[model samples]
Target: MDTKRFISFEGLDYSGKTTQIKRLKEYLEGEGFKVYTIREPGGTKISEKIRRILLDKAHVNMTGRCEIFLYSAARVQLVEEQIIPLLKKGYFILADRYVDSTTAYQGYGRGVDLEMVRLINEAATYGIMPGTTFYLKFLPEQVNKRTKLSGRELDRLEAAGLDFYQRVFQGYEKIAENNKNRFVVIDANQGIEQIHQKIVEVVKKRTLEEL
Candidate 1:
């Protein structure tokens, strides 16, 4: 396989994307492949700071336009500070989230202009996209049920109501359809190991000739 590649896992909250990415990273690294993992809105120092301000529950009052812009800004920093450099060094860069999150959560979920969100994300990353993007599909209700935030307060995005998330989920599906070659949809209801196996299957199928 082309071990030197860029990949990403995308989904709504509690879709087990993070866990899957971590496992994939471990698997790749254990096999002597260079692997790097990152989460969107953070990844780099500046981006992480911006992430805190944007996701903090105290920022609930922040305007939707501003929130989207901040996400784009953080993405720009991550691209410059981490992702691009790692890719240049031939690491298989795996991201937990990327522009799709904003495209889904902000554009569709919050009713921002979808085109505008795409433009902002494009400008942020300068069009640095992954070789493949794995999108985990699930219902908003399912995700919320899995979310275990008892005493800890949830952020504004995390606390965003269910109906909004349904729209976001639909947005993800459309985005995946819209970007057919780059996007891969997975039945996220599967167990963690199963999901990982599915990812490996896709990778094997897609990269078989190339690898």
Candidate 2:
């Protein structure tokens, strides 16, 4: 078995992040690996509280810097209280969204300082970055159409409009480029099964190399 690996899924909303995460988790567990999954900003009690405020659409006035801090706070708690312990027990950690979300959403989407975001995120995670991050790539207009079709009510972040997401989409591109070794960009436009298969292949290949 590969040394307990940390994997994260990153993408814009309605980009099939949740669907693919569930599929991968089930696949790993079926293979007898001790897989542990958690969503960003909400794995622990304290973090979940922070998540509520961050997602609340009514809080439209939330400042960009404040957004960064809240996300970092929630992340720190999840990292300390949940992720580390689970990793120590040999569970493969799969996160729906992680530090990269803050980089893309707040730093790039909200125009906060990217360097500051990276600094705080590194400190929060104690320098623990994902071994592999599967980035589901999509365009902002595509995301808009998908959101409309999904029938899901918009959250505060989603309500920020398409321009914001366009910036975020580009941010993910830069992030993936900057961290080529750690990021695997998947074309989310592919059929669900095709995307999942590509992810599985990457995971299996990396596991062998890393272990």
Candidate 3:
């Protein structure tokens, strides 16, 4: 057992990340691995407060730049308060979302500067990149069908229009272009069982089990 591994799932809003995170957690625990699961912007106590400002429909008027920093700030708190400690205790951290959301939603989707996105996350996060990241590549149209994120159509970033979501998808692909060693681009369009099987393959490859 590697004993130290951090994993995260990244994608656009309504991309089935939360559901998949729950399933993955159950699978890992069943395999007898100590796991800790958390979501960005809403993981820790103080950070959850930040999540409200970032996601509430009433905050729809938030400037793109402001949105970027809020997420970074929340993540910084999450790292210092929660994630790092669990990792230090030799737990496999299963993160629902992370810095990649900023790159996708704020930078590519909302037309913010990608460099600015990188700098903010780099400054805030405590060097906790995942050993493996599963990017659930899904189109906004399909995501909307399943999730239909009620209460608000979508935030500024998500409401940037479908064209922007396409660019965000490309942006995520570009991230994987160079960092292929640590990123796994999965076909999320498949049925959940198929997707789970692919995920299991990756997990088995990275984290072994003697069954």
Candidate 4:
């Protein structure tokens, strides 16, 4: 096991990041590795409060700058309080989402300045970057299909129209292009078991390389 490695799962809404992260955690634990699973914007108590404000459906009037700041605040708390400490002790950290979400959603999706987004993310993360980021690629139409299948009302971010989501999708592709070494894109339209197996294969390969 690569104890010091940090792995993050990224994708569009309803792209199965939560499910895959859970499975990866279980698989790692079964291999006798200590795993710490954390979600962005809600890892710590203070951050969870911020997450509530950010995700509240009623907050339609929130400004883009405010949204970015709140997310960065939550990320700072999570990294300082939980992520950094755990990594120092050599734990395998699996994050559901991280800095990339901010860059994609707020930066590209909401039209915030991309450089400003990077600055905030760098400050919040304090250079503790994820060693590997698994990006589950799916189209906006697929997102709608999955959302309907789940039978859940969209959150404030998810409620953003298809155009916004397409922008976010493009943003993710660009990020993946620029950071090919750190990103492993998986086609998320496949079966759950197949997707999980592909993720496991990439993770195993990357862990060995890191070691």
lDDT of 4 by residue, 112-135 (tens): 999999989899888778889999
Q: How many clashes show up in model 4?
A: 0
lDDT of 4: 0.90
What is candidate 1's lDDT per residue for 69-141, written digit by digit as tens?
9988898888888888887787888888988888888888888998899889889888888878999988888
Please report, in order, the local distance difference test score of every candidate based on alpha carbons. 0.84, 0.89, 0.79, 0.90
Best-matching candidate per lDDT: 4
lDDT of 1 at 85: 82
Task: Please identify model 2 stretches exceeding 4 Å from their true place.
Answer: 1-4
Worst 10 residues of 1 by lDDT: 202-211
lDDT of 2 by residue, 125-171 (tens): 89877888999998899988998798888888888898899899999
How should the candidates be ordered by lDDT, best one leading?
4, 2, 1, 3
Angstrom error at residue 162, model 4: 0.5
Tens-digit lDDT track of model 3 for 1-211? 2323688899877777887888888998998888888988778888999988887777767888998888988899888887778878778888998888788777877889988888887888755688789988887687667655455555544555678778788888887786798888887888887888888888888866422
Residue 80, candidate 1: how far off, in angstroms? 0.9
- Over the full model, what C-alpha lDDT does candidate 3 score relative to the true structure? 0.79
Q: Which residue ranges in model 1 land beyond 4 Å of their true spot?
A: 1-4, 148-152, 207-211
Positional deviation of 200 in candidate 2, in angstroms? Answer: 0.7
Error of 2 at 209 (Å): 5.0
